[model samples]
Target: MDGEPGRCGAGVQPRRLTSPGCGSGLDSLERRVRLPSRACGFLPMNYLPFRLLNDRDTFWGLLWSRRLSGSDLLRLMVFIMVACGVYGAIMAGWRSPRLSLYVAIKLPLLFLATTAFVSVFNWMLGLVFRTGLDFRTTIWMVFSAMTLASWILISLAPVSLLFMLSGVPALGTEAELQYAHNGILVTHILVLALSGVSALWVLREGLVRLAAPGCPVGLVLLTWIGMFAFVGCQMGWILRPFVGSPFYPVAFMRPDCLERNFYEFVFGEVMPYLLQGGR
Candidate 1:
């Protein structure tokens, strides 16, 4: 009774500053109940890029975490894109030592155009479909999806670098290097496809996180995905020659973007097949 408040005799102790769980205050209680600081630090900001780059759960958590604002996600997304663009552009440049600068220019256009097109696409889709997501949030989701795609590409930088350094001799005849060059092009296309799929997967997960449980993907999402693929392919074709040319001795933008337009190429590749199949 000397300093204790309302002490119960013998078995029970007074609720005092030193008593366990007895009026210790919220701060102290929080410390006892809280997760370790390191574990909590993994949630949104600190090392999130690394986690999203590697951890599937962390990437999924990113979209759902209340702690992450749309703007916060966008900022991180842009940072990832910048890293992707730089990594890809530099590797392209480094691969084609003579025309490195030329190889570098197209990728930035590809990156910027892809991002811009996706944003506009989201806005237009939102207006038409009247989905739950607003224009800004729709845009942010697209940004996040592409960020995942970009992270995938970033992971492939080393593979691209390896390809850049290895292959048939640069001095060899075109016929001699044709298959090897085709292999390189095929590899790039595969990487691009995988990255696109990665983006789609991210989009699906994020939407699921936003949507009601057990619901199917709506028509709005389906349509958006179709347009996203078409836009991505056209953009890729427009900014061609990401991999340096092994055929042409040296020329910045060798065939050049305007000269290598996609429509004519696609029509040439697919129209004849369709016509023959029809016949």
Candidate 2:
């Protein structure tokens, strides 16, 4: 009731009435209107946000992630060296005409099998490191690393084979005959030493780029340790088996032996194909 002031009931102020849906009286109605308005429009889409990738971080991360321990690298190097020795044996054996046709066929097949085995081994290594390296990269890295090691072994193969072939006339001793074999062994050591130095250099450069000046001393120490362990273990493993099993008939039969032989053949025989200036 809009009763005028001073005119109603002892001059009391007039009462004013407001509309039900107007401002100051329709809080519930306003809320309902806003809610319905939002529903009629397009719903906000939920999107997964994309982060900008830093190129520098990506490159260095790929380079330095999952660094191999000194022991593991050493183990890998040794395995490669042994593989070279086995390869040399198979190549030498295959040259013999007296071996049966079946043996000849098996020799080539053995080489293929050895390759497959190494491929699998490298794949496993990638898995262990959780590296996203493709199979080709994995194989290439493995082969290149092993080739560096094989240089030493191949250089000494001639001497080792000569020693094995030449028996002492007076002593008639197979042990004495192995002295000639030491030449190939020495060559392998030398080549491995050279390769190790090169590998260490590459590793150092890579680490420096990765860690930057953040932890120079630690990186240097770690690299040094890895190089030493890798070289020493490789040399020791290859020589150890030979010493323990001299004149052992099964020495040439083992897959490990065949693998070593193939490595040597590739480095010694096929390496010429790879040289920029052919000899």
lDDT of each: 0.58, 0.37
Encode model 2's per-residue lDDT on 121-201: one tens digit a residue: 545444444444455444434333344444444455565445435422223266653652344345434544675555444
- C-alpha TM-score for every candidate: 0.68, 0.32
Candidate 2, residue 129: the lDDT equals 45
lDDT tens digits by residue: candidate 1, 31-127: 4222223433334324555445444333333343334466667566566656566555645543465454554555545655776777776667756
The residue ranges of model 1 lying beyond 4 angstroms of the native Cα positions read 1-45, 54-74, 90-95, 98-105, 212-218, 249-256, 259-261, 273-279
lDDT score, candidate 2, position 180: 29
RMSD (CA, Å), each prediction: 12.4, 28.5
Compared to the true structure, candidate 1 yields what TM-score? 0.68
Instruction: Mark the 10 consecutive residues where model 1 has the least summed lDDT.
Output: 1-10
- Which pairs clash in the backbone of model 1? none
lDDT, model 1, position 12: 29
